[model samples]
Target: MNTRDLLNRRAPVRRAPASNPAMFLFGALLCAAAVAVTYWAFVRTTTGQLADESAWREAEGAMPGTKLPVLQFLDSLPLLSLFIAGAVVLAVTIKRRRLAPAVIALGTFAAANVSSQLLKRFFFDRPDRGVVTLDFNSLPSGHTTLAASAAAVVFLLASPRWRPAVAAVGGSYAVLAGAATFINLWHRPADVVASFLVVGTWTLIGGLIMLRVTPDWNYWPPGGRGRGTAPVFAAMCWIPGLLALVISVGCYLYATKSMTALGSSEAMLLYFWSGLGLIIGVGYVLSALACWLFSIQAGDQDR
Candidate 1:
C-alpha cells in the first residue's frame, strides 16, 4: 500500500456510543435532578432565598465604583451572537454532510429555548416563602438559556476531536453570561443554574439521538493527538471551576457569621462572588461532564 493507503489502514475509529442508551438517560435524569434541587433550595427555603436575594441585591450596585470586564463580554454576546454561532453550526454540519446532526442540533435548540420560556411563564410559580422577594418566577434565566442552548448546538455538531475544547470554552462562556445577567440584576443565581440544567437536558437528549443517527462522525481517531488531550481540555475547564466553587463556599461561610450582617454591603459582595462562583463552577463541571461522556461513548471507533 502507498503512504495514503497505509495511513488510512492505521486510522483508528472509536467505539460507537449509540450502542448504549444508558449514558444519555442518566445524563438527562441528572439534569432534571439538578434543576429540582436548585428550585427547592432557592425558592422553597428561607435561607436559600436570603442567600439568593443577597447576591441579587449586591448586583443592584453594591459595588458602586467598580466595573467588571465580564459585563462587556456579556454585552458582546447578545442575541446576534447566538444567530451568528448558530449559522456557523449549520454551515459546518452541512459541509460535513451530517444532515442528521444538523437537524438534531436545530431541534434541540428550539426545544430548549421554548422549554425555558414555558417553564418560567406558565409552569413554575414562586410562592410567598416569607423571603420578601419577587413572587414572579425567575428560576431559569432566559439569557442563560439562550446562551447555553446556542453553545449546545455547537457541542452537538462538533466531532470528538474538538468537542472537549468546545465544551469547556462554550460552557464557560454561557455560564459566565448567566453571571452577567444576575450581576446586572436581571436574574438570580438559582435562575442561572436552572437555565444551565435546562439546556443540559436538551443537549443530552440531542447527543443520544445523534449517536444513533450519525455515529459516523462522532468518533475520535487514535495516535493523532494521543488520548490524553480530551481529559486535558476537560481539566482546563473544571480545575478553575472547582477552585471557584471552593472560594464561593468560603465566602458564603464567612458571610453567614451573624444574622444582621446578611444584608450588609460586605455580605452582599460576598454573596455576589458566591453566586458567580457557583455559576462558574457548575458551568465548568457540566462542560467537563460532556467531555467525559463523549470521550467514553466515542472511544476508538469499532473496527
Candidate 2:
C-alpha cells in the first residue's frame, strides 16, 4: 500500500475534539467546591445551628396534599426513568460500537450518586418534623442529582442539531423531580441547589476526562459529522430553544400553582417567581451558548 492509500484510509478516522484543559481544571475545582459546600451545609443542617432550622421546619409543615399516593408516584418516576433511560442509551451506544459516551454516562451517574449520598449522610441525622417516615439521606436530594446527571449525559450524546430539544426535555424532567422533592417536603430548597451543583460539576469533569483520554472516540455526537451552519441549521437549533421555553414555562406554572395552593404569602410568592426566573433565564442562555459553540466548532471542522 502506497502512502496516498494509507492517508486516504486514515482520513476517515475522526479526531476527537480537543478537550479544554481549562475546563477540566475548572471542573475539578467545582467538584471540590461542591463537596465542601455540601459537607458544610450538611453539618449546619444536622447541627441545628445553621441558618433558620425553624424556616426549614415551617416549610416542611406547609407541604400540601396527602403523601400516600401522589408523592410516592412522582418520587418513583424520576429515579426509575433516569435509570431506564441511562441503561437504554448505554445499550444502544455499545451496540453501535460507541463505548466512550456509554462509559462516561455510567461514570457520571456513579459519581453523582456517590456525592449525593455522602452529602446526605454527613448533613442529615434525622428527618424534619413534617417528615412522618424516613428512608434515605435528606441533605442533597438523590432523586434530583440522578435526574440532573442523567439528563446532562443524554444531552452530551445527542446530535448538535438535536441537543436543544433533548436538553429541554431532559431539563424539564429534572425540574419536575426537584419540584416533587420540594413539595413533598422531602428536602429544603438548598438541598436541591446543592444537588444540581454536584451533578453538574461531576458531569462536566467526567465528560472532559473522557474526551481527553479517548481523542479518537466518535461515540458522542454519533455519526462523526463535523458541525455545520447551513440555513437549515437555524431551524434545528430553534427546535430545542422552543422546547426549552415550553418546558420552563410549564414548570414555572406548576410551581406557581403548588405554591399558591399551599397558601404562600405574597412576599414568598415573589421570591419564588424571582428564583424561578433566574433559573430559567440561566438555563436558556446556557443552552443558546452551547448551540452557538457547537455551530462554530462544527463549521470550522467542516471547513
Q: After superposition, which runs of candidate 1 have C-alpha atoms over 4 Å from their true positions?
A: 1-19, 62-78, 222-226, 260-262, 265-268, 301-303
Off by over 4 Å in 2: 1-18, 31-70, 123-137, 216-303
What is the number of backbone collisions in each predicted candidate, taken in the order shown? Answer: 8, 2
**Candidate 2's residue-wise lDDT over 178-286, tens digit each?**
6566556666545665676776667567656655665444223434343333224444434544564565456445645555332343334433333333233333333
Q: TM-score of model 2 relative to the true fold?
A: 0.62
TM-score on alpha carbons, each prediction:
0.88, 0.62
Worst 10 residues of 1 by lDDT: 10-19
Error of 2 at 128 (Å): 13
lDDT (Cα atoms) of all candidates against the true structure:
0.80, 0.54
